[model samples]
Target chain A: MTPLISLLFALAGLASLALAMPRHAAQAKLGALWVARAPWLRGCGWAALGFSLLVRLARPDWRTGLIEWIGEAGLAAAIVVVVLMRRPQLLRGLPAVVLLMVPIAALLLR
Target chain B: MKTGFRQSMAWLHAWGGLIFGWLLFAMAATGTASVFKSEISDWMRPEVRMRTDPVDAVAAAIRYLSVAAPASSGWYMDAPDDRLAATIATYDVKDANGADEYRLAALDPVTGRPDAIRDTLGGEFFYRFHFELQLPYPWGRILASAAGMLMLVVLISGIATHRRIFADFFTMRPGKGKRSWLDAHNVLGVLALPFHLMISFTGVLTLITLTLPWAITANYGADTARAFADLDPGYYTRPRAGRPAPLGDLRAMLTDARARFGGDAIGRVTVENPNDAGAVLLVYRNDSNGVGYDGGVAAYDAVTGRLLSAYAEQRPAKSLYNLLYGLHMGRFAPSFSRWLYFLCGLALSATIATGLLLWTIGREKEGGLGNAFVARFTVGATGGLPLAMAGFFLANRILPVTLTGRQDAEVHVFFLVWGLATLFGLLRRPARAWIEIVALTACAWLALPLVSAVTVGLPYDIVGLGFDGVALALGGAFVAAIPPMLRKLRTVPKLRERRT
Candidate 1:
């Protein structure tokens, strides 16, 4: 159940990154290809963040909830960074990737 | 005013974070390490690992204490549970001068007799150092509070500077000059923003009395201690009248407490006014779902064997505070959560490292290394500290237990290694220095499991593959780092090639 929620959140973050991208090529070139896909990507990111929160609320387990919460926050922060650095935003996804990977890895390892 | 406000804040965030970043990183890393301090202690002590049930040892210690210190007042048993290796019992007695004296004994897990576990200082040292740095009084606490404030400022300014919060969501192009650094910082900051915020806020709150004494002074009328007492009802002020009194059996009390709480057995037992009329035994339940360092403390009347008060009965506000504290400390989490915290902590350290590296790279690109002694210090600190930590772990493994001053020697080695790393950073080229330190770090980390396997006959496989797993993971990371370090070392030639 926790993994499912985390996966959904990760997908959302990916979507948000896609949403955050600019439409035009000139701006896109300067920021890099990932930044260009920001428009949809931002949406996915926000959704992931929201879902992560929901999972935390639903799950009574503190450890899983905490990990999910951290993962969500990371996704949200990535979104915020993307919106702030309007021009080039491809690197904003690192936190989400790292955050999501931790819990997922823990689940696998455990 | 607006420009100045933004500029001042930016400056504050930058300089404050840069100055304290290394310290904060250390605190966080150590705190994270402390989440698994017991497990680490268990791995370090092989003698304790062999005994699955150290109950007999604990019973033996109780018997020993009962005989050795019969009239000495009360014995507080810090029994071994799932987490820790050794069970410690301390007897409270008064000296001829009428001062309290605590005689402590560590019981062997197998024999339950007084045994010396290797003087490695175990996990508690790192745990204590996280908040106090083992310094006297307010200094360590004050430093920690200052770092927390700095972290808060960084979080705020970092958010303000990154205007397009929603636009750049999940994007990572890796090598895009300044864009990459900004992305890296943003990603790390954003992903763990809540963690960063919660940790800092709770950290400040943990030391709230020190940070905001004005509130306590104003409300409680200059009686800060009273204010704390009000906040923490578990604190007892009145001492028991000195009289030899038979106390309730702690082992039985612990069993009752565990049954009541529906949790594991008691971890630590604290007896106040032992041998006094009003002697109270406070048995602390092992870590559970609830939050905070202070768990359910069940107080038993020494003579009556009746429950006086339980922490579970505390008011909502107090309970909420405990929960928040627990959450922040990761005390409530099971073993898995502890592991997760450990990994996240490492990532946080990596985040700081990457950020420092980006700052240096950014400045270097502008036109040679700038006169930012602060940035230089940060690089030295963030990079050098890890090397030092590895040295500490190595010293713990290598230093002979029988050697005089071995404990102090281990601590000194940590400082010496860190100091040397910093000196090397200052003396050598930054890129080259980083490569060298990283290589050293790798060697040190890789050596740990080998040392453990050689000294302790417990093969890496049977210890649930924990030590070897960590070593292999760290070693792989170091091996992967070789390419990057080599690439940075060859930067000048690459630039020349590009120009040609």
Candidate 2:
């Protein structure tokens, strides 16, 4: 439920969504194999987003938590977009690492 | 004015956005800075060292007020938090001419008496400038409200005018000139659209009372105070009984109020008719713990320590109003969320800047006075604001602490720098102005930590260090901007610039 962990999930989620798009997929050279897995990637992206929201909502003061989640999501998404623009190849590796790291970090931190 | 609906909306978006963008950019930038109001105030006032508990500070304030203004009409303290420990106590008293006036004191957190505090507006200047632009009376507020309304209009029209919203959601073409600027503007707008829309809506609504007072005027006639008082469900009033009685323990009332608030810390303490039999003590819970701003308030019998009435705003309309107001003011935001608000605010400012740049970028060959004005004005407003804000801080550090009208001197320096920077922008070529002012701003902001380090010796607290860190970060960002500006400045023909 920590903002940092939630932010990583959001970053993973948005990067997934961005990579699913053909234009971005081509820009990032995410590979034909990755592009072919668009639907799965999109689904995982949304699932990560939902989990991020759930993590934020898990706070005792969920009202404040929900608001912070939205703000952090925006911040996270912005970071992904800027990374995609500057170093598209960075997107190829980071999201997968984030996807693996987030849940483990969340559990350990908790 | 345009043939198509989208075109007409775009026309409105471009024109209206630029017109009010000057004030709106300033509003957003200052509002962003004011998010750390307490922290900034702490940075500005290195003199306040004690981090006293709210309960203890309230007790100290009551003790000092009891001895100093025994028969004062009322005593009020904006209870301090951990960030800024000093309490600002105001005592309502009858002046020699029989008119009501306030005795103000910046109570030392430890002693609860006025200290020889430096008379700078501190974060309050930015907070005030956000909505008021430091102008006289209702004028600045009204203008800000109007600009806020226009910002909402521009946001909506821009949304309407945009095509393929999702296709460009992640798009950013940084080196493609106009495409890049447009992409940035659009991304900054759409990424933080919820924030932008909510801020614009709530920002205007916050000042609606001042801008459009029809409802209050019609309902309460001339008694706006009564109208506002009636809006809050916990309001109370009791005439002073013509007998003297010592006030009860304010610290106990605070402890009681804390439990009453279900552990929310007290943010304000007010003692009405202190020393009278019917004296009442009111404690208000801090609004920072929640997004909703219905700060639970309780009125207590100042003589007997009995709870008189306790309530929070629960009326649907008022609750909604408080929620929206709280969102705009960001009083409830924690540090991370507050920084998000600040970044979103800066994005909005950048959107306006890029939008203004779009107008002049394509119209360089149009040879029109309007284009010329926007070209110059954009540089002044966008680049000049941060410079002027830095000057305000520099003045706070540099000014003679005991000089007469020290507060006014700080404020005057703020406005003076803003005006001078704008005038410089207007007089100089737009291209050169952008480079020079931005460079000046970078240096000014970079100078903040250095100035503070030399003057106050830079306290090692989070608030103090955080201010320095942020100032350094901003300075770094502006320093990064100067090379791009200098490179662009070389492209314009000196003769073509002279034609304007």
Instruction: Point to the candidate with the largest DockQ.
Output: 2
Docking class of 2: medium
Question: Residue B490, candidate 1: how far off, in angstroms?
Answer: 2.1
Q: Give the local distance difference test score of model 1.
A: 0.65
TM per prediction? 0.80, 0.92
Report, to 2 decimal places, the DockQ of model 2: 0.70
Supply candidate 2's per-residue lDDT for B82: 58
lDDT of 1 by residue, B1-500 (tens): 23766676666666666777778877877776787776666665556654534335455666676556656656777667666667766686677898877655556766666545665555666787888876787999988888888778887887776666655434444546567767676666666666777777877878877877887778999777788777866544356576667666656665666776765656666666655667776777765545555556677775567777776545777667776677677766666456656666665666666666666666765654453554466645767776777778777777886777565677788778878887777777666777787788888878777776677654543343775787768877877777756865677678879999
Residue pairs in steric clash, candidate 2? none
